[model samples]
Target: MNPTIRSLVVPVTDLAATKAVYSALFGEPHTDESYYVGYNVNGFEIGLNPAGNGGGPVAYADVDDLDAARDALLAAGATERDAPNKVAPGVRVCVLADADGNPIGLRGK
Candidate 1:
């Protein structure tokens, strides 16, 4: 898959404050909870997470096959930051770190 950034999960210390800020910009969140707050702007998904990458926002690229995409990145020098985990019924996600330690998020099956 192309390096198409479909969504972003921002790491925040305070969910309530961050949610309020994003809510003002993006309006009501489609999914809101203590763990996550999600918004859909157009076809792009934006999320807020308190326990995230521990740095900046992570960009998740939507793919058809999560395993293939993740393996490709790992073979190309990326290291696994987080193993594939199911976030939703059909959606699995993972985070990998590039050579320079930039987080790469994959969202798909």
Candidate 2:
């Protein structure tokens, strides 16, 4: 599958403060939920999550096939940090850790 890094998610300890900062930086949020806030900037998505698990930001690649992309990553020595799971009706996301334990996110529709 051809994947592109279209999203970047940052973990925040303070949701309100973080949301305000991102809102100021990116104009306004496209999505505002208790768990996640998303902003669209020139076709790319910037997301903020209070419950995010990783140590730093996660870059999410947009993929046509979530399973295929995940399998390919695993085959290439990436460890699964989170299995592919549906976040919305048609959106699915998975997390993988690189050799250095950096988190990478995969999103599919």
Candidate 3:
């Protein structure tokens, strides 16, 4: 499977406040905002996960075979927060944390 880091989720308390700061820094408004506000910085997406329980920044990586990757992580001592499932058309993912509790989002690309 070809895996590449895609979007990174940055946990924040206030979306409005963070958005303003990011906008000024990047010199561009967010490209879209829904469940999460997303900004396209160059080719990478920097997102604000306001309601995330992860408590830190998360790296969402693009994977060709999410199930395979999930299995590999599990075998290598990672715990599943959610099983791989389709979240949208042509898109699916799951959250996994290594032994140290850092989040890595395996995504459909």
Question: Would you list the C-alpha lDDT of every candidate in the order shown?
Answer: 0.92, 0.90, 0.79
Tens digits of per-residue lDDT for model 3 on 64-84?
A: 888888888889999987567
Which lDDT tens digits does candidate 2 get at residues 6-42?
A: 9999989998999988888898798999999999999
Best by lDDT: 1
lDDT minimum window of 10 residues, candidate 2 = 49-58
Estimate the TM-score for candidate 2: 0.93
Clashing pairs counted in every model:
0, 0, 0
Lowest lDDT block of 10, candidate 1? 1-10
Error of 1 at 99 (Å): 0.6
Deviation of model 2 at 21, angstroms: 0.9
TM-score of candidate 1 relative to the true fold: 0.93
After TM-score superposition, the amount by which residue 75's alpha carbon in candidate 1 deviates from its true location, in angstroms, is 0.7
Q: List the residue pairs that clash in candidate 1.
A: none
- Order of candidate numbers by lDDT, starting with the best: 1, 2, 3
